[model samples]
Target: MSDAVQTLTIVIPLQVKPRGGRKAMVRPGVLALERRQDVTLIKAVARAFRWRRMLESGRFATINELAAAEKINASYVSRVLRLTLLAPDIVEAILDGRQAPGLDLPRLLAGFPLAWEKQRASLSPA
Candidate 1:
């Protein structure tokens, strides 16, 4: 018998890229990509809209009242409420799991252009 042994190697094309606040495992060949929803973001977006509605509906007197009801911090509630002002496409990107790198809640809430077009240009991948 020969002393040498044969070995086989298999490789799947993939890349680790920064898609948002985290690094993502990117598979190249797959036509339909599986993107798991960021539940925290989804919840935040939903809460923002809901809170806005409640306030507009006069169900809550102030952020403090809403915070008390929700058991969240009043300041945090206000910050989250600002999420309502985010551009629709930005919200859509978050929902679709296609948000740009570093597009986390704090990053978005920190500040965004008031203009929808500017927000889109700044937030989305070029």
Candidate 2:
């Protein structure tokens, strides 16, 4: 071996594609999987369900009362309460961090079809 200057080259093989408009590197025939948990959305969903439970269990007399106790707006509380009406599978997906790309607390609060089937169809696993 000589202590002379030498150049080296290296090439790494990878496949990059867009997932939900974000680039991801994946192996052939394998989709890039992201289990990145949306903590904000998860907490919002959990709080919504918990709030609904409080009202149903008679722990809170009304949304106004709950809102006041929680230090949040009644209208916002009302909107969050609607999360309880989401399809079971949708809720499960949310809990398990497997919901569709666009599903989030804001989107859910925007409103959805009251029918479970429609909800499933709109927010099915992707």
Q: TM-score of each candidate? A: 0.69, 0.70
**What local lDDT score does residue 97 receive in model 1, on the 0 to 100 scale?**
75
lDDT of 2 by residue, 1-126 (tens): 999999999866778888778998877645423454566777888898899889989999999999999999999999888888888888877877788887877888899999999888887774
Q: On residues 20-117, what C-alpha lDDT tens digit does candidate 1 reach at each position?
A: 68987778733233354566877899999999999999999899999999998998998889888889888987887778867788787787888889
lDDT of 2 at 43: 84
- Candidate 1 at residue 52, lDDT? 99
| Model 1 steric clash pairs | 20-101, 20-102
Alpha-carbon shift of residue 27 in model 1 (angstroms): 15
Per-model lDDT: 0.83, 0.83
